[model samples]
Target chain A: MPNKGDFWEVNCYNNSLMYSHHTKQKSLACLALLFFHVLLQAQSPENDFLRSTGKIYSVVAGIVIVFAGLAIYLWRLDRKLTKLEKHINDEHETS
Target chain B: MEGFTDEPGVDLVKPEGIRFPYRSILNETIRNTFFHVALWMAMFSLYLVGLYHAILYLRTSRKDHDLWSEAYNKAGILFGIMGIATGSLWARYTWGSWWTNDIKLNMATIAMFIYFGYVILRSSFTDEEKKARVSAVFSIFAFVALIPLVFVIPRLTDSLHPGNGGNPALGGEDLDHTLRLFFYPSIIALFLIGCWLAQLKFRLLKLSDRVLKNR
Candidate 1:
């Protein structure tokens, strides 16, 4: 037979393991609750319809293109200004 | 309805699931995350650029550095205002009020006042060199003050805002994976736009300076 000390030690180890396992499962359940909340929010019919038709991407593409164009234009303007500043400094020095 | 994916890279996780996380009140308005959070991030970035120019002005006493600092500060303040406006709207939608007694909000207001004072302080000095020196020093001090006021204090105490007071509103289980794609881009876009605005303003300041010299 196992010694009394050995028995208690094994019992304690099992109890601690059980406790941790229980907590882990509880936390997992909480995560599921949280994701369920997100799922519910996304259940709107109109939003679903738009996504299903892939039409939402047209809007996304349009926005992306416009913003990209604007960024390019701004970058060119910045370069022009830098050149102008250099030209002005040259004129002033020559004068 | 069938889930569709015309774009290959876009999410097709579920027929009905939005790839973004959601809280009850923040449901659809979670889209505002791009605007509200990105504006503050952009503002902080622009302010850092401004502070760098401010330090450069102090070191070199260059007129262009002073003007650049002023332009960056103006753009930073503009984004700050946009941040506050978007935040207030988000607050009203979720927290049921446009303003609240939250520590973060109050501290942010104080930070704005400090920067605004920096502008007024600069304008008060008649001498150009004196204005640049004093304002540059003030900008450095204000930025230092902002760190503790806006960021540090909020984390150290209980807060109703997400990511504070043990709230699970921002990290781990809260921020959805797909949102990162849009969120990061929003920050980059806003920062670029703010810098663009600053550059434009800098050009105007330089042009006016040139005209004044010519006259």
Candidate 2:
């Protein structure tokens, strides 16, 4: 992925080309190449398929399920302990 | 100044860019550095607390101390598992595999096994005092062993993991100022949450012990 740095470099290269013969045509050619570079990047299928279709929601859902399981298990264990405490207190009171 | 040297194709006379360094392999998933690395950091901090409680148990021989140690250790192991999972996910995207033969990963598994053995050893003893004493000793041994297994040995050998065998890990070009902003906060948050879980587990265990004694 050509970042801003690459764009800056291309602009610098374009400035250097300004001193050469047929300056206007060459500069226009560089401009065309820059547009093509951006177009190629926009059309790239590498990471876009998952991201654009929002299929990453599946991954997020899986993680959320795991976390929810842990939380629910902890909550149940806490409730069990509370019940056990109450049962023990009732037994002592009856005795 | 540092940003200028980040990209190879960038012209020397051009101004520095605002965006992150776009490496060929680690394009956007480099953000995983914060999540994955922070989990490991939180795990280590929790383990250190567990070790401290183990030492305290050995000194005081208190049942509560043992429970605290066990709770913290369990919480720490949970964080370690999360770290490994996140790391594997990040690896799948960057390294083309969920798991690799990297020395760091091997050593991490070993470290986890050593801690698991500590828990298994604790469960084998029926007597509370005996279990506490034996596990405290084992905890200390495992902590010392893990230092070499996880940190020292991995760095000594050639590995795909960064910061080992000439690879620069985070803080040395891998992590930059922008990444650090998120990374440090993630570490702090994970650590706090781990501690909270440990505290909850310890209280639950303590309450169970009291109920058993009352019965």
Q: Which one is best on DockQ?
A: 2
Worst 10 residues of 1 chain A by lDDT: A49-58
Per-residue lDDT of B2-73 in model 2, one digit per residue for the tens?
A: 221255232222236655444444545445656677778888888898899999998888888899899888
lDDT for B134 in candidate 1 is 89
lDDT score, residue A28, model 1?
Answer: 56
User: For candidate 1 chain B, which ten residues in a row score worst on lDDT?
Assistant: B1-10
lDDT of 2 by residue, A1-95 (tens): 34445545655766765566674786677775876575556435444322222223223433553365458647876887789778878988999
**Cα lDDT, model 1, residue B37:** 75
Cα misplacement distance, residue B130 of candidate 2 (Å) = 0.5
Quality of model 1 by C-alpha lDDT: 0.70
Q: What is the C-alpha lDDT of each candidate?
A: 0.70, 0.71
Residue B94, candidate 1: how far off, in angstroms? 0.7
DockQ scores for all predicted structures = 0.02, 0.05
RMSD of 1: 21.8
lDDT of 1 by residue, A1-95 (tens): 22335434544544554445565877756655655554444433333322332233323333454355446656766786777677778778988
Per-candidate TM-score against the hidden true structure:
0.64, 0.70
Error of 2 at B123 (Å): 1.8
